[model samples]
Target chain A: MGTGYSIRRVERQDYEGVLQALSALTTVGSVSRTQFEETVDHWNHVKVSSEPEILQYHPYVVLHGEEVAATGMLFIERKLIHGCGLVGHIEDIAVSLHHQGKQLGRALIDHLTNLGLRHCYKVILDCDERNVRFYEKCGYSRAGVEMQRR
Target chain B: MGTGYSIRRVERQDYEGVLQALSALTTVGSVSRTQFEETVDHWNHVKVSSEPEILQYHPYVVLHGEEVAATGMLFIERKLIHGCGLVGHIEDIAVSLHHQGKQLGRALIDHLTNLGLRHCYKVILDCDERNVRFYEKCGYSRAGVEMQRR
Candidate 1:
């Protein structure tokens, strides 16, 4: 009725804040802050690099009132095969805990898909069997059989 | 002289092979291919996702005579802080048991590092303290203390 939230790209400075916020998010349930921070750090390194080649393939984040509310990647593959030799990955979609149910997650994913379309290729993402419904809601189908040997 | 050794980026199809090769590099020496394949599937999902607010990074491998000899990530990050902000990471660096010589590891790190320097604000990675020399030789200096809550 009053103001609809906005979706934006995440920036570099948001790393620590997001990590801290995730620590808080997990505090609501599962992991401890220390454990969560490690995951966040691992994610950070994967996203940002001291050297840059594949960096150009990555994209930015979205901010709601100056706070990062959602994030994802517009992943691209330069190698041949898998649809005209170029493909996109829909990666690391996260929504702020307090911001759940606002459709911010949907909007963020839609934005990523549109970006992929702009590049003219397929946009793909894999989810835990637990998240199949959430991704289905986001317009992604069960594309293939993916297994993790961890 | 015989055919001189060389360096190059990994082909996409080469991944599944390396995924299987990881068993030989495990801390305990080897793991079951069945167990190894599962983790590879998981990491594949992680690397392929790049939705709205998140960054997704991946690994690159070095080849010697059609075999993977060394591996690391071609990481990237956005505007990040040095002491505070963090960017990308280079992870899972392993040299094949049979190809330890020929400077394959050094060549792989050099290639991936250059890729990161071009795009992101910083490139960072973590390894067990025992790997200090391995990373140091690759030009990584250790300073900050890293603790994981997980």
Candidate 2:
């Protein structure tokens, strides 16, 4: 929370800035300008397409002066069965390689968790094996198993 | 495919019918007429509030004559890193208790999987330990673990 960087919702101008931050993450490749614009449009509050109601998607970034330092996406889900009516799912969290150790990732996660608590019963995220301890240090305890395909 | 039942997208009138079916899955209290109408409105076309583009949400139900037999919701997600551009996530699947032991569950999963394949690289769903074998029978294999909080 004490980071010099400011965290805010992503904007059209932040597309390239976010991409620069995303480059530090593994497996992501070059995104065309058009594709990037489309992504920005989707994340923007403006309605371009009719998306399902269950996913209330929000993407945010941390800016240090003019440079993007970290980014994450969050989705609010409505649960039918659980007594908890709303919950959050987080995906695609990344910090610029240069910003790794400065508590930037921790700051970003904390910010998201706070936001989720405002509307969601609780927030959840999935990480690879390497990041388990990192999340545990952030006050998250391991629960269940993660399964995926493709 | 020939169960004398037709799978179709949910419509406004299907609200009560679907809610009746959903009641079997959990303890959902009765919904006011206005709430039911609002839910149908949300599911019918897409945007209630603006949402991101990655997920194309669709909720479907199986109709046997005038009765609703089963239901499921599917989401198509676009992946950035994987060569696979899109994937599907299935949730909120339910079958009427009276309809159990029939292949309705399998039929619904297969139907959604086919829909996912049309636009996604693969389809995925998470199940409780008890239902793991059921999904395995539907051609999904255990690939990883699922973790969550709240």
For candidate 1, give the docking quality class from DockQ. Answer: incorrect
lDDT of 1 by residue, B1-150 (tens): 015455554444565456534435543234344434433343344442233334344566666567666665544433212322324545446676766766777777667666665544456655566766776777776533322110
Across A1-150, the per-residue lDDT of candidate 2 in tens digits comes to 454788998777776777767667755566766666665665454222243323366778988887888988776655443432566667778888867777888888888777777777667776776788878787676654443444
lDDT of 2 by residue, B1-150 (tens): 446788997776776677777777766565665655555555454432233333366778888887888888876544443431565777778888767677888899888888777767667776676787778788787654444555
Interface Cα RMSD for all candidates?
17.1, 3.8
Cand 1, B chain, TM: 0.64
Q: Which ten residues in a row are the worst by lDDT in model 1 chain A?
A: A47-56
Complex DockQ per candidate = 0.04, 0.33
At residue B16, give the lDDT of candidate 2: 65
Q: Give the per-residue Cα lDDT of candidate 1 at B123.
A: 61
